[model samples]
Target: MSKQPPLDKFERDVLDESVPIQQLLRLVIVLGGRAFSEPLRLWARNELQGYPGPGIPLPTYRMITAPLQMDSHSRFSQGRNETISALALPDVAHDLVSEQLPVTFSVGKLQNLISHQDPHTPLKLGLPGSAELARLMTSERSGQGVVVERIYWSVHASALHDILEQVRNRLLEFVAELRATMEPGESEPTVGQVHQAAQTINITVGDHSPVHVIAPHRHSATVSFPTRPHHRWWPRR
Candidate 1:
């Protein structure tokens, strides 16, 4: 009988008795992708620092914090021929939210497992860039000072899911084709080669709670935050 692969640290941590999977699930957002860019490439390199064997590295864990900025613009018009000019506020408060605990996976092994199927097999995969946009508008005419407000919000949950799923499916298809084209006794392609060929990005938003704010208009405000976390993850060419 074939021996089962040993569980990695991440799997052990999740299955550990001390750390309840329920609470961890609440704190963690699981994201997987075959298309890897600088952010995930660097993460994989760092994670594989001491890993053994030729398989792809395990997932890496880190706490990422960054300043979020929001900007708004408003305009009012009476008719198609009329133009209205509104006051441009100099200083406006911006809402910022801090997210936590995002888990990322390389998923090369998973792709390899799926690639064992026939080359012509088809998988029902999601679209590439599914997204949702939300807008809200409020107006008060009877108030002493008229207040007209509009809010625009967007989220990429569907898009992220689509990219991840499609990337996996594509990887499977590529691997199947490669296997089919090889000689009868030729060696198969490595997981790293398959991963290197297919690169993608997948993100999961965990918590959207407002953490802190940096007001450039106010000198007293504390504006201490690291430069974008993804910048540090650029892969060394």
Candidate 2:
């Protein structure tokens, strides 16, 4: 029988606590310059065990349940504009900071890329090839650059503050290591735009009754539950 990969401290804690799925949040990490989709996907899969969605849940909770998706304009061609998203529950976000999983998992994965000097390494996860394209995008010598456009998290109001703190602290370490790996004399890459916004839904009454949509801005239409029933339906991200 194949041996299972060892779980990190955070992973152990997650399993120990049996963290419930409170809120599902979508985190989009946009790369400004060309990011080879295949290699990036491979890297995520091999190192993080984050594969294309719909994915089975893992202990890490930092699963990339979606594939590397590019903007509509760059769908057919290799373009600098691209996006990769992953899903994390509130409990998972908490562990990333509390258990220092970002340093061991996130930074460790990045360290693998910097240590391998060859850009043409075979495409293998946890191996050199899978990270080749990702390495190039971040390398100053390659001329092709990669910058984060933004990191947006669609979350509920209650879990916003806690999740934001975890993400911010973890991202600081992640970005720092990425910059440290750049070629000599290369300008350090800037941290990508980070936006945390509450998700909103428009609820319309089926009885032709006036509805009050409360939010900074409103768009999209959804069926509103009747107030008489006091039905509680929380939207998922």
The TM-score, computed over Cα atoms with residue i paired to residue i, of candidate 2 is 0.20
Q: What are the runs in model 1 whose C-alpha is more than 4 Å off?
A: 2-152, 190-237
70 Cα displacement, candidate 1 (Å): 10
* lDDT, candidates in the order shown: 0.27, 0.26
How many residue pairs of model 1 clash at the backbone? 4
Every model's TM-score? 0.24, 0.20
* Residue 217, candidate 1: alpha-carbon lDDT: 28
Q: Whose lDDT is greatest here? A: 1
Q: Report the C-alpha lDDT of model 2 over 119-216, residue by residue, as the tens digit.
A: 43221222112133233223422333332222222222222223333433333333334334434544322222111111111111223332231222
Q: What lDDT tens digits, residue by residue, belong to model 1 across residues 93-172?
A: 11121222121323342233244544443222211110110011122232333233322122223322332354334324
Top-scoring candidate (TM-score): 1
Which 10 residues in a row give candidate 1 its minimum summed lDDT? 127-136
